[model samples]
Target: MKNLMKVIDALLDGLKRVLVRFREAKLGLLFIINIFKIPDFISDKRVNIINKFRLIFALTIAIIYIVSGIDFIPEIIVGIFGFIDDMFVLVWSLGIVNEEIEKYKKIIKKNKDPKIIEDVDFHIRD
Candidate 1:
């Protein structure tokens, strides 16, 4: 019973941490959701081929990690802990990929409109 409780507590803590990070990285989270729209988003002829490839690669890796069942922490060994590692990796990778996407967006926007001098702020702050 104690062990079960411990596992539950650990899972809750992990969840809290994930939520905190999600809050801090709202733009990244949003971009991850936007992954589904990649085909439409990248349809613009002005979008660089390289940027499109980067987004596709990152998303592919993320999908593979999820579907391959190759986990950093196996559920067989640790009850709830197993899933946390995968979530961490996915979120981390998405955040990175989102940064790249943001950069690409800025380039496209700037090219289309010469008056804009700075990158648009995507950060969501408390």
Candidate 2:
């Protein structure tokens, strides 16, 4: 019983941390909508060519997973549970892509160099 209580306490603490982080992010409930804007990120030439390719590839895989009608977890068999894996992939990929886009924009803002935008191969490393 004591071990169970400890486990429960740990779970609660983790939940609290997640809640706090979500609130701090200020992304709102509709933040997922922003993730769907892959084209917007791809259109921005300020982002490096490599990052753009990564975003495009990730988005293509996501689209295939969703539209192919056949996936590692078939929705016809498990209903909503089947979609969970695809959703997880999309959410994870979108988060990474969003971070890359933001980083690229910040670099452009900080440098304010027209040459930086033209130099698609160059990346400002920390």
Q: Candidate 1's C-alpha lDDT?
A: 0.70
Candidate 1 wrong stretches, greater than 4 Å: 1-25, 28-37, 113-126
Error of 1 at 4 (Å): 27
Task: Report lDDT (Cα) of residue 7, candidate 1.
Answer: 95
For 15-62, candidate 1 gives per-residue lDDT tens digits of 677566556556645666756556654786667788778777767787
| Best candidate according to lDDT | 1
**Which ten-residue region of model 2 has the weakest summed lDDT?**
21-30
Candidate 2 C-alpha error for residue 11, in Å: 19
| Cα lDDT of model 2 by residue, 13-123, tens digit | 755664454454345444555555556667876668898888777778877877787776788899889986676556545555555655665765676755545636766
RMSD of each: 11.9, 10.8
Off by over 4 Å in 2: 1-46, 113-126
